[model samples]
Target: MPKAKETVLEIDLKALEHNYHFLKSKLKPNTKFLAVVKAFAYGSDSATVAKKLQDLDVDYFAVAYVNEGVVLRDSGITKPILVLHPQPVNFKTLIERCLEPSLYNAKILKEFIAVADAENQTNYPVHIKFNTGLNRLGFWESDTDYISEHLKATKAVKAISVFSHLAASEDLTEIDFTKTQIKNFTAIADDLSSKLGHTLWRHLCNTSGVLNYPEAHFDMVRCGIGLYGFGNAPEYNTELKPIATLKSVISQIHKIEPEESVGYNRAYTSNGYEKTATIPIGHADGISRQFGLEKGAVFIQGKSAPIIGNVCMDMIMVNVTGIDCTEGDEVIVFNANHTASEFASTANTISYEILTAISQRVKRTFLH
Candidate 1:
């Protein structure tokens, strides 16, 4: 990769391939891999990412909404796409596009059936989401009977897959809770499968769950962050490479005299005479306002340059007093060396938030 002339999020297809294979290594040969391409493939151009993954023969792709799946469909993605949080209004379009919906609650399940019936669909694939421990979404354990009855009553929709989300699979301290969630999910899957009178594809593992729980990798595994180079743990992180590198160039350099301030609201005042380099990336570009005043940094000339003052909507000034840098010099906001995870730690956040928060305005270049 060359030095970026401007702010660019470099998408490394080769690295993505490496991470995909690495994650795939953890699963059994017969297990299916579902790539989560929602949030623009973690804010790195979903069309490009999904195309690359499609070429790699990823079994399935998951997105947060029906529109996201439609974009992939328009981009020539032919694989099955699961809309994890689809709405009733888009159910018709979802079916028209051949996108499967994760029918979670009873109302959503009934509504989707109505739409599927209106379209005169037969045995349309739909996933049933059960709430194991993640109270955020999905039906309750007892809702299995309700779901089974509804599916038996309607030939319009079929529960092709039954799944759940893990609440704290990445936290070792929550091992007991995570295990309990898994056990409960298995019970629910069995009960639902027996009630339905046919075997349904069972999956209950996310990125962390895939890494930590091999027994729960039932029929398929949904991997999101792991495919983008995060393993959710220090040991596993060594095996995967980050697929996206956020890079920018110093737009200008400013020499600040003692008592002089930088950025909006005069948030930072120079304690001593120092030099600052302003980069064309800020809150609007996904560098949140929480990352400023020496908390966040951008690597320049292989040296750490702390961000100064309040991060503006369009730019951020970093203290580059000792770094030998000039205008237009390449600046690394976060990459493998000074990773997005580390940078996000400075703001007390996580890699997922930072990676997905990257603005679409940033030019996305790729390396294959």
Candidate 2:
């Protein structure tokens, strides 16, 4: 394929590997690492990220849905993949793709078991998600009896692991709550194991959990944002390298007279005689309208250019009055100097939102 001539999201594979090794080094020798590659690997291209992680000998891969796992599988990924929220409609395809599902409720459990039985599958591996404290999706502690019964009834399927999510592992102030969650999850895992008379791998640590609670890192640790470079803590920022950099080029430049308005709805007016550089990127390209009207800015010539005016569907205007540049000058949206977290903070959102909100229409270029 010809190289893209417009905006591009530069993905750094070496930085990805570096983050993976950094997290791995922190874990116990026996602790497994599962790289979360959902939302197109946090909008950086799942197939590429999964392929790199696979080459890195990652213990496992995880996605939010069955189709995502299928994507990885079709891309020649052979490692075990956990589907965090598999729906009943795709159970057949999931099974066919050798994707494991995290059974969170009794209804899903029974439904999946029936499908597994009809398919005449033996020992189909599945993971059970317990609701430790997230209160999102997962079986509640009170539903343990139902889980025990279901496991015993579905002898055709194998319970490979029992896992729960920590709701606030990133907040050190919530240590007591975190400990309570771990304790509850451990108790439930132990109870289930005893009743089922089988050993089930138990996991409760995400990136933050792994960093804060070593004891909760039972059999595996699921690292998502951390693997992409954010450590979920201020202290680890210096150690992790961001893996994605967004860049675009100036499409045109216009000189604005003082008191002259710019862009749709005249959201911004020139404070003084200044130069405005319009870039071929906007809300349609995942740069939200919130970024317009002075909320967002980009870096040009190693200096910040404040965005001015309403963000249009296909373009935005940046104040480049004094920047030594012309049409086609390179602009950095986020990079080593200006991180995604900084951008997110400026946009009043989170890093995950900014990362995943990147539109697929934007071209992706990988750099080792």
Candidate 3:
């Protein structure tokens, strides 16, 4: 194995297992769990996370695209994989790989039904997504009749589950809106179940939903961020262990004088003589530009070193004054000690963006 060097993303499989079990415990008995591993398992390595979840006996895996499902299949994951935003073009490959698609709209439903029929597939599971409130994807409440009619007409396609996404399940301030969404989804699910005359698996909760809305657990729950640690709620933070940490080594150290400029465009000027350390991580490695010029920081010698000046493509300068840091010193950008959520908040973004936007070029080291 390559030794730890410049920038590395440390993945904690043990924490992943812990989060998985924590979320699983919140679900209703006999209810299934779908591990959402899309976007490279939220940019931490999908194959590794999926394999771990599979070993943990997760009932299903969900991805946002067919290619993501393909990744799981290639990794020898035998569990059912749900493609949330599958396009018609990948229908053939999806069937060949035994990957199920989430048919959201009439167009997708009709196209997938035709493809299934042509492929001689029977009871090939596909999910139906309803637009309860997110308004991002899924069929509208009014589109239910058309969807039902098409499903009835297509004998080849099988309705595996009916699901919706929560718009603001994490925001307690939006509890009313979240309740409205739940009500809408429940109404739509009831209508669809009655019309189909057969019960299909129902789910509408993400990690936040699993935590906040146990009454709406339905038949299954899809978990993404919760599995990676941050539960979108402050109370659950202590229960869930973060699965990934961004660490880098100090590449160089420099002495700065009072009134001296640092980094690009003189974004930061030293207040006095100070020691600065340059770390081998930057926007190219997923540290956003917004983190530059005092917005972001790294932990060194158990002390916080505020980032100085603009973040470069491959390097970030930190004011390491009064610190004993030297070249090759390990610096933590974000970890269980310094949560990614804090960095994200500094950047005016969410932890999901921070995790998912991590560049693929960085080295990943898995730890148990």
Candidate 4:
């Protein structure tokens, strides 16, 4: 591959497809697949990712906000979109765009009902979210009775599914906690379905849940990181292929003497003569400042070059003292060979953060 003139995020469609199919294979044939494409499809272009998944016949699409779903709908996405955290303010737009909202509380549930009724809509699909230990969002399991009574009174909205989020599905040590969550979610879902007088779709699995707890795969599974090429566990990660490869070119190189300092605040002082290379990507480009001065690195000519100073808004300096590299050489920030998970671990974060932190300004190249 040729060196890019500037930093670029190369999206591998084949790798995405591989991860998608691998995850799908883990599910029963009858189960539905909900691909989470929010946060710009985890920082990889939501419209593009949704289109590919749609082509693959993914059963549903989910976004964190209504605006994201509208973008997909406007782009010709006809599949059902579930807004994971729909605000009351966006209820009108969501209804107009035919985007389903996950009603987590009585306030939002009642508010959305009013909107649907004023619009003269009937049976507008809505998902009911229950608090199953994540304690982030969703109605209490006890609220099931309240939710059921509301649905009984309103014909404008219909509860299509009952779901909850797992708190620690990724940690094997938390298996017991995960099981307790699943058990509680199952009982609540069954009771809610009974109260509603119909069997509703029940989902309680995110990516890790889908990988670690197959028994909890109720009617559907929401896959976010797994589709982006991470399984949150080492063993499962090997079966998935990373879809994004962030690359840049060495803009310049310099030789510094002993006691010389580099970058803003002179954060790094050279103990001896050292060679450094500067790349055209920095905090503004989603390379966090915390990664400065030995905390982070970039791969050049298959060798690791440790960062030497504070990461600038649009540039970063790396120590390349012994590396056989030069200006214009390709630098791999993180790619298939250098996993994003490993890169994020160095900064005390996760791959999801690293992937989504990538700014939209970086040129995105798609490989079909």
Model 3 lDDT on a 0 to 1 scale: 0.91
lDDT for 302 in candidate 4 is 92
Spell out the clash pairs found in candidate 3. none
Model 1 stretches with alpha carbons more than 4 Å out: none
Candidate 2: list runs displaced more than 4 Å. 1-5
lDDT of 4 by residue, 253-314 (tens): 99999999999999999989999999999999899998997999989989999987899999
RMSD of 1: 0.7
lDDT of 1 by residue, 1-368 (tens): 79899999999999999999998999999999999999999999999999999999999999999999999999999999999999998988999999999988989999999999999999999999999888999999989888999999999988899999999999999999999999998999899999999999999999999999999899999999999999999999999999889999999999989999887889999999999999999999999999988899999999999999999999999999989999989999999888899999999999999999999999999997
lDDT of 3 by residue, 1-368 (tens): 23357789999999999999999999878999999999999999999999999999999999989999998899999999999999899999999999989988878888999999999988888899999888899999888788888888877987878999999998999999999999998888889888887888999999999999899899999999999999987899989999998888989999989999988899989899999999988899899889998888899988999998999999999999988878988898889979999889987998999999899999888987
Candidate with better TM-score, 2 vs 3: 2
- Candidate 2 lDDT over residue span 1-368, tens digit each: 22234789999999999999999998989988999999999989999999999999999999999999989999999999999999999999999999999999989999999999988899999999999889999988888788888888776698999999999999999999999999999999998888778999988899888788888899899999998899878788778999999889999999989999999888888889999999988898889998888888999888899888988998989999899988877888998679999988887998898899889999999987
TM-scores, in order shown? 0.99, 0.98, 0.97, 0.99
Cα RMSD to the true fold for all candidates:
0.7, 1.8, 1.6, 0.8
- Sliding window of 10 residues with minimal summed lDDT for model 3: 1-10
* Strongest candidate by lDDT: 1
Arrange candidates by TM-score, descending: 1, 4, 2, 3
Error of 3 at 257 (Å): 2.5
Q: Candidate 3: where is the Cα deviation over 4 Å?
A: 1-3
Q: Quote model 1's TM-score.
A: 0.99
Going through the candidates in the order shown, the clash numbers are 0, 0, 0, 0
